[model samples]
Target: MFGDMMNMMGKLKETQKKVEETKKRLDSVLVDETSSDNKLKVTLTANRTIKSVEIDDELLEDKEQLKDYLILTLNKAIEKATKINEAELAATAKEGMPNIPGMDMFK
Candidate 1:
């Protein structure tokens, strides 16, 4: 019984280490999304924070249109970023807990 307890404690420590490594890797990941026309772009961190946005000079000619395009582009970029983050998180969670049921729910 004592050996079993020690083995479980070791496994828990290993899992904790893996979780920390995954967090660090996720923090370092970045996702970039752009509009179809390339007039607008957005960079997002793995945690889904907007890092930056860019707009082409040609779009500046029409202020109203530029504004609309920017909004649309930003929304699309955010959506893309969200999907990427979700996929990555799912993958990481699966890798960390392959045999555990409902493991991703904690993520």
Candidate 2:
């Protein structure tokens, strides 16, 4: 029983290390999404951190349109980031759940 416990502890430590490394990898992932017609652009990390935003100079003429386009583009970027994060979660979680069969993509 003690030996089993020791083995479990080692596996848990390895899992923890993998989790930390995956987090770092996810932090480094960046996705840039742009609105159609070049109205707005957003740069974000897979973890949904917005790195920057860009607006076309032409959009400055209309605050309302700019606002709408900005919101739309922001949502698009975050949506893409959310998908990436989900994939990352699946990949990361699979490390701890090796019995799952269809998680090969995550691996």
TM-scores for the candidates: 0.61, 0.80
For model 2, state the Cα shift of residue 31 in Å: 0.6
Put down candidate 1 lDDT per residue, 3-25, tens digits, no spaces: 77677567657676776676667
lDDT of each: 0.73, 0.81
Clashing pairs in 1: none
Clashing pairs in 2: none
State in Å the error of residue 77, model 2.
Answer: 0.9
Give candidate 1 misplaced runs (Cα > 4 Å). 1-13, 61-63, 98-107
Model 2 alpha-carbon miss at residue 57, Å: 0.8
